[model samples]
Target: MTRHPSDAPTPPPAGTDNGPAVSREEFDALFATVRAWGRWSPADRGAWNRVTPDLVRRATALVRSGTVLPMARPWDTSPGPDNSRPALHYMSELGDLEAAEPSAHKDFIAVDYHGKAVSHLDALSHVAYRGQLYDGRTARDCVDAGGAHFGAVSALGPLVTRGVLLDLPAVLGCRWLTPGRAVHADDLVSAEQALGVTIGEGDAVLVRSGSLRRRREEGAWDPGAASAGLHVDAMPLLAGRGIALLGGDGDSDVRPSPVEGLHSPVHALALAAMGVPLLDNLDLEALSAAGAEEGRYAFLLVVAPLHIPGGTGSPVTPVAVL
Candidate 1:
């Protein structure tokens, strides 16, 4: 297989006779294709570059004509590893009302381990490889008197662009994609055909594996259970397509964590190495349904990560205007 610049090392390629996973060189070649298509810049330009004004006009018309819909789900508790991450906490305050009834107030705190909720985008400063952050900045450089860094969600601005949802489960003949299932580039193409839309450059491509539904129904995460996610080989495909953001419903499809046992190497590769953003734990059920019903794939996509400074990831509410 031809290697792309953005392709990370992967197992041998898939085979008709169950051969080893894709070779590293072949994976690299695939990634190179993605890298070649990307507009490598730190500025906040997203998938809009790939969208034509005509497409935007059509989407707007559909919204005005009530042919398309906006799909956004209300945030509830987030999912985590065995519910280890606290989803919400409340601090109560009691106050005296003098001669009146006692008064109290409760402050609500939410932990966003589930990756759903109003949150900020994780800057490269949030994670490190060998202790180096984005732009070669160290964690120390990101801290000050407050010990804060660029990881805060507030650091990210409004990420406005044309968003495309690739419904992989629909293409794969399943309502719920299982864990450990690797979605390939061909799956993406099939989804595009099914949706009657073509993915273009600079689009924020969302891959829906239906894993979120299973997780929600199960009500807890099983560390040992496999979950559906992007194949490592698909990175180059995304990069080759010039996708600005690559988001999905799970952490990643790769196994065994790449950074000395640290999970989420996809974050490292996309955010740190490729300068691309990764959206996780997004609620795509409504969007998928709407797209299928309307027979359209492109939409006016809006996502605003929390502006928190020096934070790793933020809970986000992403909306799609069809």
Candidate 2:
């Protein structure tokens, strides 16, 4: 059987109703406004500090049907427009060793996960804007050739909390949001109203633009060149809500960026300024269907990353339970 490439529709031309173009001065001011420096004791954990013990218990109470949904895309080993450096997977041992008492088969897998093709978490150290990390840590002073000394993925340990899904395609009555489309703050508010859900402090908010659905239906396109996701304008609303984590099918930043000279303004806002981690390239299609069927968009979310002490981030298969 042959596998089709991931879906990517022809995106609209730039400067066509994308959104208001933001200037560098305005963006810098916005960054300053949202910066959460010196707010938490362990600054590396950033906004995750809001997920208190009570919050964890409350999140646990959200489990109802005992249905579990894994949101990670398959480790894409096939090269395509979307997967440039395809993940590596192969059998190291084929159970043919002569000295072995019992035949044993083993496989090895590796990936450069911090890209469009992998489902992974972004640590605070994963992104630094203007030479600064979260809590005013200098990028050069903290991150080095070995690994990050501050805001590494290890500080984020395991994240267990309430997760909210904003299914934009479902809310807008579309199969998928066209690439280059930008989800704004108003859209978020409308989604909350339509879905009967609210964004609260410590919530892991997942926005679904139906990119994967389009990928499965259409064909592969370079998401690094164009993709649908949240605009920089939406960051203020998320910041105001005090969300713990942000994620989506895309990397949570609209491509052909509206901001001048900034490719991913939302990344800077969420990771560098707000000190919030991000879950990128999640396959939220199953979760979208589950939410529509259950009539509730909130669920208990569990994110367990491999404990790589000095790592910037880790590939993760986050789970949502309802």
Candidate 3:
């Protein structure tokens, strides 16, 4: 029987074949090594505090041709294996009886965007590992059904900084990485060298696994279940570099998570430990092409999330300017 998009698939059995590979002991040790609980002063903004006026000015200096690319997937109204809860868009007011002389068309839009479908920003409160959010705030104390009381999307308004495009497939001479491939820290260094770009302080690292492009040509699969992205080992490098933000076609976590006892282990280490808010499910094909054409990978990246008070995260359309 053909499964409908609305129908959730039966979860595979958990073990070495399906679940995370690393043991609990290994995952915990790695978590403690990179945890930055008390580093940032005002913890709501998290690692974004690293981006300063000087860094923004420096980022602006990277823009030469002024080519702009918006890195958001189209408002996804269709449900699929990846898009479990599809975005909603409909004309609420056609403005026939409501308007006097002039007619107007207005639409209402909403989404459960933190999944694999939408390009969005994940606030620090979005992920809570071991009952704690960023800066060691207890998740139960800070977040509730009402919404997050700390590290809400409103606090992370506009982020503008240097963006590094690690076009992995381009570097590897492939169209796309296989779904479940893990990108280690060595891949980052190799990609940087191959692309003639170096990631400095306060940079927003945008990695392109080209999974979305492959899905376009091939077919849609469950990215949340299996997607090519950075492993937990890769986070230490970015964390050490003082990255303001991290983003990718995937949510920066390779699955089956290298770490056991966690589904999104990288998310936990990034948001909860390193205080690094994440940008997830970006369509970086345009950015990849732009980088190849220009022969440069670093550019001025800009992200502005909706200012929803106490919101856990926001649907965002990040732009890369070269």
Candidate 4:
């Protein structure tokens, strides 16, 4: 797809009644525009169409230029093997339903979702806007007792494409990115320059704000309390480039509110309205350090989110091979 001469502006707030829901006609038109501009063939029309062979070739070229780094923080649930994070517990056994296994066979039967895992990405099914999921799938379609409507961890296919890492902390010369820190479009460009890479259309841009570092060190990375992330100003640039996925090292850059609560602006606006997937809580400190030391950036980015039929985000391991 032809890149916009420059990044577009951020979208309006989702709750604004003036900003009507994107109509079917409007959605179809936009999709058609992207398809025509990208010279996409109908035969390549599934979700994977955005990340074609050419995209993989370019991504691989970047990876071969240097060392590919894994950008996922290790999920630490238990403290001293006793005290554990609640989120981790829910993820591992989905509420301790499998805790009855014998010690010797525990590891064998263990199905802990919260662990030091990687190579995963979030499906559009993970989040929604006004109760609607990606591609207009309803929220109800994603849940069932037997399993997720879409299935788990195996439904998502390989996501291979040109992945750009936007290191905001490095760009700003900050050691840690805080909650509520709003990164604008200029910040993304600045980070791109620091890495000597130009983001392209359909790239899976991973934005790093150093939030993971804080989580690793403090053991408490509260989305509601932390400050970090791209402002709404960065969305247009992302959308205009046909970005297929937006990855980050935290649940979101913006802080959650107690009163006028919004889960995540980036996720809701981009995925539900624009059809882009959001990959969150990634680990990128190691990758950033490696890139800075080598003075090179680019890599074959690979993330295959669990194919849970109707789940939102899955634990993932995102690897960046240089």
Question: lDDT of all the models against the reference?
Answer: 0.56, 0.90, 0.84, 0.57
Model 3 TM-score, all chains together: 0.92
lDDT of 2 by residue, 40-150 (tens): 979999999999999999999999999999999999999999999999999998877757678888999999999899999999999999999999999999999989999
Q: Over 4 Å off in model 3, which ranges?
A: 1-20
TM-score-better candidate, 2 vs 4: 2
- In terms of lDDT, the best-performing candidate is 2
Instruction: Give a tens-digit lDDT track for model 3, residues 1-322.
Output: 2111112222222211322366878888888988888887688998899999999999999989999999999999998898889999998988785657677889999888889899999999999988989888999999888899999999888999999999887777667777778888888999888888888888999888878887897799987678888887787798788888999998888877777668899899889998888999999988887777778889999999999888989999999999
The prediction achieving the highest TM-score against the true structure is 2
Q: Estimate the TM-score for candidate 2.
A: 0.95
Q: Which ten residues in a row have the lowest lDDT in candidate 1?
A: 1-10
Weakest ten-residue segment in model 3 by summed lDDT = 1-10
> Which portions of model 1 miss their true places by more than 4 Å?
1-82, 91-106, 112-120, 135-152, 216-219, 223-225, 254-262
TM-score, every prediction:
0.71, 0.95, 0.92, 0.70
lDDT of 1 by residue, 109-182 (tens): 66654333322345445555445554445657775566345434444565666788787666545556555666
RMSD of each: 7.8, 4.4, 6.8, 9.2
